[model samples]
Target: MTKFRPCIDLHAGQVKQIVGGTLDSSTDALKTNHVSLEPAGHFARLYRDHDLRAGTLSCWGPRTTRPPLRRWPPGQGACRSGAGSTTGTPGFTSYLFPEGKFSQERLDAVLHSLDGDKQKLVIDLSCRRRGEDRWFVAMNKWQTITDMEVNQETIKQLEPYCSEFLIHAADNEGLQKGIDETLVQRLAEWCSIPVTYAGGGRHLEDLDLVAKLSGGKVDLTIGSALDCFGGSGVKFDDCVAWNNKS
Candidate 1:
């Protein structure tokens, strides 16, 4: 069944919902949709109260000023932090250092470190459409495009090394124009493991749309569209209700 997975994005020590493509090295290039005054712990507790599992607490930019994740209240559900991996292999060992430059040696190191424990890893295959009907993975805060194509071949090869895949449509992310149905459908067809698709979700019906399009195989994550995140398109309570349906 399709579920509403929640998210809390921290950028430069503040909770924010930013347009994916607009994020880059230059601060002026960033386009932010919402900035929450409440701390991350607030949303963490809220999701716990609702029993929302698998929610992500992602750090969008430099974490120099960001508070340590430990300080946040527990019960935020299982979190996958993707920030501060620039120096060496992250403690999590899932995210790639240098943010999306493809290196077979680095990949092998990560895979070897896992020692066949795939469940501890989740690959972020977020991408952008290019050429004609092709999607290439975007990296470096979505400013660079890698040569890897997000297709069945890639998914099949990586499936055994990772437990789940988190894909965001970089071009449509944070636009609230509706999800890339083509991308969602392709993900459902390609992935055997659990996949969560985020970006361009505008309404509650999108949840149903994803369920129908993916046959309830792929879960949806609505960031800028949820009311709690300063969006008016969908109510947080309604999503909870949808999840609670018998």
Candidate 2:
């Protein structure tokens, strides 16, 4: 069935849950749902102790501050997060994989980072609707328009690089309305690797619906609605119970 994966969204070195679409240049417009007083490493250790795999580490920082991530210990953490800048971070370059070629040195660093066993890599296909039921992956903090479409072909091309796919329906993300059911269904049919869906999950039942719709091939992440974050629609303990049962 659909398991509840964990997530730690970092903004300015703090764990935060903000409206997905509002993440643009202006920090003043952010609709923050919750900002944890706990440090990012705390959540990392918590998830590690719980054996929560497929947890995401989305770094919304302007610069790559990896000391906190290192404190989490990559050995003990089950996270697939990215740190990027519009221009690019120095050591951990923000540019896309081989596609967004900077220098050979930078490209090598990016590729080498994803090295190891197949399960080490997970590609994030954060996207928005293009037109007429069509969707395209968004880049550069979901601001730049990309021609890359979220079709079987796109997944197939990315399959060689990663063990799983993490997709956020950027439009519906953090809205707590409902999931893009069509997108979940489509991803289940398209992806060969494990996939996780995040965005617009307001209630606990949405997890069941996603499990049913994707035939248990997809997992869910609830942010604004979870009690741990701030809102109170879905209790964090219940999500743990659901995963345990599954």
Candidate 3:
């Protein structure tokens, strides 16, 4: 079954709804929709109403800011939801660490916001080197401070508390070019828990490719080519239909 999983990617401390392909080395080039002037949980609550479990909270680097303090001390007061309609959509939160910028304190803060519920969490092992914005380097090739490999180790440390993994072949991300078969197979063999592979999806058939390569275990995140992401080939509605049938 092809399920529709939406995302809210946070970059440079902002809640941006972006078109995947537009992201590049320069922030100025990225096309993003700013949702709030506050913390990320607000968005998470919105997804919850839609039954969107596992919405990702992605961070680009150490520059990522902490959510508002007032919202902390979870369960203290009623969770005030924003004015909107949920309409039952599925989503997930991921924290994409830029190369050499992984921080235990920052990760701890994100985990604390979840209030000890591992099932609702998904961490993105995404990283790029300094001054490089083309694509995220693979875990093995990374050598800098913000490497995804380091971030993966961090997630392993937090494994007892986390639920799923969201790893992207930054080298292939947003390209809609092709899949990195090696990475897909490796993640399926290495990770015990469920993981979503994002990057280099050019068509619907690519999903089938992933299913075969990962033994129908690993899922995928499609951007760039999706109709919503400024592309005309892939239809978001078709994905929903496929998920319904599955």
Candidate 4:
């Protein structure tokens, strides 16, 4: 079924909704949509209260600013998110995983590590559109575009390595304009495993659009537009109700 998945995107220990394209190293270039004063636990409790499952808690900050995971002190919170930098480095593609010598071995080593637990890995295929209809996968905090194109073939090839795919349309994320409908349709067609699509969800009706377009196969994540996230488009309670009905 097409469900509404919740997300908590933490930046510098605070929950925030940020523009996906401006996620470079430059603070001046970074555009923020919403910053919540509530800690990660607040959202965690809320999701639990509403019986929301498969929710994502993403830490989108540098290592130094990341929140500690220790729960020793009662008030302290724990959050672990992936971070990277592409500033001042030319040809950052050199840092691409399994690209250099013994690339196959490196890839095999990773696959071997998860041999019995491949389901624990979830691949994020966040991407940006190139020409009119082409979408290429972006890496390194989405600052660099790789040669890989986001299509059925790529989805099939990588399916064996991960249990699920989380795709965010780089251009539409945090804009509250609308979701990339074409990309959602293609994802529905290509992906056999569970896939969650995030970016540019404005109203509650988007859930219906995704349900129709993907035939209730792809789940949608609304970040910036949710009422709890400081947007007026979709109320958080409504989302819970939608999930209950779904």
Candidate 5:
């Protein structure tokens, strides 16, 4: 059964939902859909109360807003924090780094930082379809198209250094169009470790679809489409219920 995972995407230290592709180095290029006045801890507590674990807390841009959002809240359900390549804040069980430039130095730095503790690490991978309908990893907050293709070879290579994988379909993220079906199936077939797939989830139905497509191997996260995020496509309560039932 595919479980419904929740998320808190923090940009500039505030809780907000933005188009994944719009995240870039420049501020003006950003396209935001919802900005929550409540701090990131509020959502963290919500997830905790709902027992929504294995969710993602992603930092969108520069660390202008300071700590606490990307810094996972203590005592909350198990959540992964992805803020910087080398920094793992308090309460985060793992460091979910963005491999933006595909540099050996960057990979080595993360590996060295782990110091033989690969279980406390994760790689946040977002990919877009390009030539011949293949998924190639996008880096730099899903703005840069890297040469890294997310295939068995890549998964095999990264598996030695991380406990699991978190993938976002950058092209459909926050659009609420639909979950990336191909990516879900591919991830289910390829990943040996527990992998979570997020993007284009418009309703509770996508959860069932993901379950069927991935053979219940992939977990999901909804953002802009959720009722809590100023969208009416999916109800947060319904997702909670779905998780409980499944």
Candidate 6:
């Protein structure tokens, strides 16, 4: 069945649900929601309530802030030391590492914050350079790092921890111009796990294109042109129905 995978995108520690195409080049272009301060876990819990499966928690940009933690009593110093200090406030931050370091410290911190079975969850390595489309840059500044290549070795390393992969062709992301067939095909062949391709989807037909090119194995993320994302031409319900039928 085609499931509705909703997303809660976090930027600079804020929970924002935005149209993928409308993302601004500058910080001024972001729209904020006053009601979404409860962090990624809150939305994840809501998704659990709805019985929605295959959803993702995508963190963008940098992990400049400390990990969020469960609210603690004042003067108890619960978060003043140890892993408590390294961990972000629970119900607030989603424990996303923007640089994709996946270091022991980062992995430990994220694992510590998870409330459910770790094996069942799929973490999104969703990232992009601001103001660009179709290209992906590494989130970390490791000395061995080079260009924006999504090679086979990297995928192998991440496979054990993640069940699926969410990759955006940043060069074409949000442009609604067209799909990146090469990237889709490569990812589909390179990784054994299921993959969702997001970027440059301006119409319903693009979905078909993705399915065809990826041999009916790849899923897609639509934005900007979708009615839900403040676009008028494409109806979100139609896409849902299409997915249901397909």
Which number leads on TM-score? 1
lDDT of 1 by residue, 1-246 (tens): 889988778888889999988988788999998999998888877887887877666666776343454533564434554333321222222245344555656666776776746665667777899976689887777777877888999889778777788888889889999899998999999999998898899999999999999999899889998889999999999999999981
Select the stronger candidate by TM-score from 4 and 5. 5
Q: Write the per-residue lDDT of candidate 6 for residues 77-170, one digit (tens) a residue.
A: 2221111012432211123443433454564555556553344335444344433223343332111222434657767866665456666555
Where model 1 places Cα greater than 4 Å from the true spot, the runs are: 64-77, 82-101, 112-115
Candidate 6: misplaced stretches above 4 Å? 1-5, 8-26, 29-52, 57-105, 108-118, 127-148
lDDT of model 5 at residue 30? Answer: 89
Q: Would you list the C-alpha lDDT of every candidate in the order shown?
A: 0.77, 0.73, 0.51, 0.73, 0.75, 0.51
Off by more than 4 A, model 4: 64-108
Please identify model 2 stretches exceeding 4 Å from their true place: 67-77, 83-94, 97-109
Query: Which candidate do you rate higher for lDDT, 1 or 4?
Result: 1
TM-score, per-candidate, Cα-based:
0.88, 0.85, 0.58, 0.84, 0.87, 0.60
lDDT of 1 at 191: 95
lDDT of 4 by residue, 80-173 (tens): 1222312121111123333321133443444465563555555666789999888987766677777778899888977876667778798998
Task: Encode model 3's per-residue lDDT on 1-246: one tens digit a residue.
Answer: 324354445556665544344554566766553334645666555444444333344444235543442433454321221101111111122222333444556556556666756655555554332342223433322222243342345445756655666766655655567877767776666677777777677787777788888887777766556664455557766655555565
Residue pairs clashing, model 5: none
Better of 4 and 5 by lDDT: 5
Cα lDDT of model 6 overall?
0.51
What order do you get sorting by lDDT, best first? Answer: 1, 5, 2, 4, 3, 6
In candidate 2, where is summed lDDT lowest over 10 consecutive residues?
Answer: 85-94
The TM-score between candidate 5 and the true structure equals 0.87
Model 3 is weakest, by summed lDDT over 10 consecutive residues, at 81-90
The count of residue-pair clashes in candidate 2 stands at 0
lDDT of 5 by residue, 1-246 (tens): 678988878888777888878888889988888888888777877887787887777766676343454333564436776533344331121123334346655565666766757777777777888866588877666766776788878888777777778888888988888988988998998888888888899988999999999999999989998878888898999999999999
